[model samples]
Target chain A: MKSHTYTLRVEFGDCDPAQIVWFPNFFRWVDAASRHFFVQCGLPDWKTTERERGILGTPLADTQAKFLRPASYGDVLQIESHVSEWRRRSFVMKHQIRRADVVLVEITEVRVFARRKGDGSDPHAIESVAVPEDWRAMCE
Target chain B: MKSHTYTLRVEFGDCDPAQIVWFPNFFRWVDAASRHFFVQCGLPDWKTTERERGILGTPLADTQAKFLRPASYGDVLQIESHVSEWRRRSFVMKHQIRRADVVLVEITEVRVFARRKGDGSDPHAIESVAVPEDWRAMCE
Candidate 1:
């Protein structure tokens, strides 16, 4: 599968009081990278997808990450992301965050295409849908 | 081990375009819950620990999380956290985020007590330290 790279610069606010990139901020960047991968693959934005197909967005089902090294503000980082596997209702995305040649973190996420549940029980509820063939083809 | 619960109200800014809580924000809340667990165990703040014992903070080595449900702004959530296991130089924390009686997310984190590496190779480098016996005692 083709991979997409999303580059970002660490900001002071991204770091915690310990002067290291707060772990949660890494997730934020990875989330952006996930979306960037879809965009680079010629997929429409979530809003457009929702309007066309009722797919609101891809929401994470599960995620695992290993933090190998700490990153601080002023560092330029690149996140290389790709869809590693496509399941019936979910897919796995693999992401490697690197500062130059050093890999700082690696993450694997299982995400599903979700749409709002219109059953009127809970307005905020969402349900996952099967992987769309067209979307998977574009990503591949 | 004793467990601690941290409560917070989800804000509008924490949600993404889907009007659900952005996944990364869950990590942020879990991180806070981790620290709050330590504080509830009578451990000093990171600054004090660093000043007195050269322990900067517990930095995550690895983490895994499962997102069970989506939450939106105006929801009041509680994260219950506790150390599930302690290794020689690392420990595992388990967190469950809930809205009322509904569990929204579950996370497991392997973290280490880290200190700045003063050997002068990389200023931002950090090294893990063995779990402090006194601190572990306090937590237990």
Candidate 2:
């Protein structure tokens, strides 16, 4: 229900010729912040999991992002994400992108389906399954 | 069956602490390439629609990326995207991540739904909607 926020600086590639953050790159910042949250909560990032167990998973389903202000290259930004809702079917995570403490973008990503263990044909239907106990134990 | 590719130099922020390209960043790169495709087709990126016309929509389905190699900072990479399938109800986009001629990732995005504008209560459904004439008319 609350958030974990992290800070990162916008690099040159994160911006465009206009010297502002490229629109699509917002997802990168959100994903990086989300990864930080997962690691902090004990879920290994994809790379770590692949190295240790040869398994990986990522968000599937839907997403929406709204840009409120322009972020320039070299700006120090803060990203925050929290479990906004948890249902038997799925969970919702909300993220906010800000520059120098000013809000820049608001995002909500709904991750429902996940595939693991290098399987392409079969997807683990998380909606029909219960949240892993570890998820509840960490961000609670 | 053809692709429109975009070239960009990798930056540290695009990688993980291990100095390899992060998974989510691959999605960002493909999206940037998609915008490039739109430009080539004579359409403005969606941000222009959102900011200039208030006609905003976003993908509401799933996107998946398969990572084949590590991409590091200072490496100039190319992302290729093309319409692999355009059916009556939905479409599919295929993406390739490459460094010079070496392929690094292959991705496909299937959009099941879309959030559209000008509806009274909720966003409009997007099943079977036609790709705009100008956009589709571009290679004609």
Candidate 3:
């Protein structure tokens, strides 16, 4: 599959008192990278998807990450994201965060396309939908 | 081992365009819960640890999280955190986030006590140290 790269600069606020990027910030960046991948793949934004297709967004089911090296503020990082696997109702996204040639963190997430539950139950409830063929074709 | 519960109110900014809590914020909360657990266990703050014992902080080596349910703004959430296992140099911290009686997310992190490399290498470099017996005793 084709991969997309998202570049970002680590801000001072992103770092913990220990002077290294707080681990949670890595998740935030990867989440952004995941969205950027879809955008770069010619998929519409979540707002557009919701209006046109009732697809609210891709929500994470699970995620795993390995922090190889610590990154500090003032560092420039690149996150390379791609879909590694696809299921009926879920897909796996792999992201590698790198500083130059060195990998700082590696992350994988299982995510599902979700929409509002239409069963007249809880209005805020959401349910996953099957992988959209068009979306998959664009990503792949 | 004893567990600690940290409570916080979800704010509007934590939500995404779908009006649900963005997944990364769950990680941020759990990381705070991890620190709160240590504080409640009678362990000194990271600054004190670094000054007194050369122990900087617990840095994550790896982590996994499962998102069970989605939460939104105005929800009051509780994160329960504890150390689940201890290795020679690394320990596992587990966290569960709940809204009322419903579990929203579960997280497990493998972390190590880190300290600055004293040798004349990169000043920003850190190395893992063996789990401190006193700190482990305090937590247990």
Candidate 4:
């Protein structure tokens, strides 16, 4: 799988009073990474798909994470993200956070189909729309 | 609506390449707030339920957010969370991230039932075990 790399510097707002990276901050990085990767790779702008679909396009069905080490303030970290599985009804992505030579965190976020066009009642609808061919091609 | 507060410090890990709070980090902060509010108010532990139920306890069903101001590293942000509504098998919660008096971001997270504890396969089950009586009283 082709993993995309995104890097950013830690600012004062990303840490805790302990001066280490706050745990919630990790999800933020993954979110940004996903958005950037999709946008860069050209996939109908995943961010705005919700409006087009008339429903919330992104919904997390499940996620599991492990904290390998503490990320401190002022550190430059890299986030590597890739599709762990791209299924017909849903998709799973894995993200890794690292600094220099060390890995700080690993997270798996599973997203499911929610509110289809015009209605929010569908329970995990297998999207009738196929995953964009160009998007899949980029993963290749 | 009564709101609960959760205080967190920013870590370098939560920032963008520009050292601003990454978007996904907002989810983390709101989640922390949810966990803290539930636990502090004596609600059942989500982790424990997941173990007993063999199902993922909490999943984000829908989330919409607006970024007001950027949060920087080392800033202490307070997250205020409150239940917007409690309906059959679903609920809405509102969150605001603030640095002292300034609002950094606002979000609405809607969560629904993933599976039933008795049988994890019945994804159709949509029910909340009634907010504990004590929790209702506390909220009242």
Candidate 5:
């Protein structure tokens, strides 16, 4: 199982009036970590893929997250992410947000390889594509 | 059931390289919508509640969100939020994110009214408080 770790510093703007890191900020960091994992696994930029293969990017189909502990601004957090499962057209990515040895949040996301609909159809329409074997090999 | 709506304009920084509003930004808006619901229902700010009753803001325990459509910068989105269920120590909030009549995302969150542990214990420790009758009445 290959894993990538993304580190971030919680800034003042990331916290709410309660002085704790706002929950949505955690999602932002996790989303960034998801992309970083792919980059580290040798995947090209999404722009390149969209231009070459019409593969826009991985778009999340479903996501569930649990907050186990609260973090405050100025804290340093690390997100450890890895692909936990791979299906025909979708995959699950798991992320554990931790401060030192204490786990703060956990997230699991199901995402698909998306491509814009062609054939003179709706410009905003997108559909899922099968998992590319070469991308999977590179990730693994 | 009483519901409150909050509207916001998507800003440039809220979008990603794809020129679409990033997924996490929707969570941010929904979080703000959750707070706005309480405010619209005539509840005081978290600061007031914390000072008077030792009740911090509601903290999310779990959340599930589905992205039905993508949004972009400059788009105006509205979120309709309301309390769908109330339990002893937790409650569920449902948020519908829309651009006019088109729903862009749906989110359901389980959150708890939290208070700091006062047992001369760890400062960061927090525990859920039973749903306050007065507060529930205000929301309803």
Candidate 6:
């Protein structure tokens, strides 16, 4: 029921040659918003979780986004993110990018709580784990 | 039917605190791969197209990605991108992120050839235009 809003200012580097905010930059902001939602809900950092239970962080399994309007440099956008669902080993995060009263983009992502396959040395080896009850409780 | 492969070496900044390639960075690479596909196909940059026909760039209308494996700094990735379909005002691009022969991620995007609206002054005013025949020919 609770949501977190992350504010960001579009920078020159964030735009493309067309002088509009590149679409990928929206994803960057969304990823940050996802993390901010958990942090705002008082969950421990990923490092602490990894140390305690081998949970590295939330990695996306599936992601979809729709772009409605264009944004350019100097624009300030707010991304509101919240948890929409929690599965056995995954959760869905929903984000809406807005400027004032206008919604510019919408995104929904399915992410899993992952852990290192071995000792975390092999960068490519990681697997998802069951949803942590404490994490779910804190987020919800 | 021709596909373009964009090779990139993952950098330190491209990763997140978890020391893995951030999901957003994948989108960034995908954007570049999209442009690279056009350039490799002999089309001019977006600026030229904008000046010639009010075509700014291919802006994403919808995108979906599935992450199959994780990548980290110092890894090398090759994104093979090609236009899979050409619609009236939009096109679909398919991209596969690979390392050597291993598939790391897959993404498909619906993008439009967009132009500035209302004399190009208002940053938020932009809309998709019909796919240019010349542009499509070059890409195909």
TM-score of each: 0.97, 0.51, 0.96, 0.48, 0.92, 0.95
RMSD per model, one decimal: 1.5, 10.4, 1.8, 14.6, 2.3, 1.4
Q: Over the stretch B1-140, how does candidate 6's per-residue lDDT look in tens digits?
A: 98999999999999887888988889989989999999999988888888988888888999999999989999999999999999999999999999999999999999998898897788778899988898799788
TM-score of chain A for candidate 6?
0.97
For candidate 1, lDDT tens digit of each residue in B1-140? 69999999999999988889999999999999999999999999999998998888999999999999999999999999999998999999999999999999999999999988875355378899999999999998
| Best model per TM-score | 1
Query: What tens digits encode model 2's per-residue C-alpha lDDT throughout B15-109?
Result: 65444566567776776676577678666666675465443333423454555555778889888778776654345777788888888777776
Clashing pairs in 2: none
For candidate 4, the per-residue lDDT at A91 reads 74
- The Cα error of candidate 3 at residue B40, in Å, is 1.1
lDDT of 4 by residue, A1-140 (tens): 76789999988788644345655667767877876766666655533665675333444545666665566667899999888888875678888888988887787776543344334342223233445555567765
Q: Score each candidate by Cα lDDT.
A: 0.93, 0.61, 0.91, 0.65, 0.89, 0.91
TM-score of 3: 0.96
The parts of candidate 6 lying over 4 Å away from their true place are: none
TM-score of chain A of each: 0.96, 0.78, 0.95, 0.79, 0.96, 0.97
Which structure is stronger by DockQ: 5 or 6?
A: 6
Runs of candidate 3 exceeding 4 Å displacement: A119-124, B119-123
B-chain TM-score, candidate 6: 0.97
* Candidate 2, residue B81: how far the Cα is off, in Å: 11
* DockQ in order: 0.80, 0.08, 0.68, 0.07, 0.62, 0.83
Q: Let me know the DockQ for model 4.
A: 0.07
Evaluated with lDDT, which candidate comes out highest?
A: 1
- lDDT per residue (tens digit) for residues A1-140 in model 6: 88999999999999877888988789888988998898899988898988988887899998999998888898889999999999999999999999888999999999999988876688788899999898899888
The iRMS of the candidates, in order, is 1.1, 9.8, 1.7, 14.2, 1.7, 1.0
> What DockQ would you assign to candidate 3?
0.68
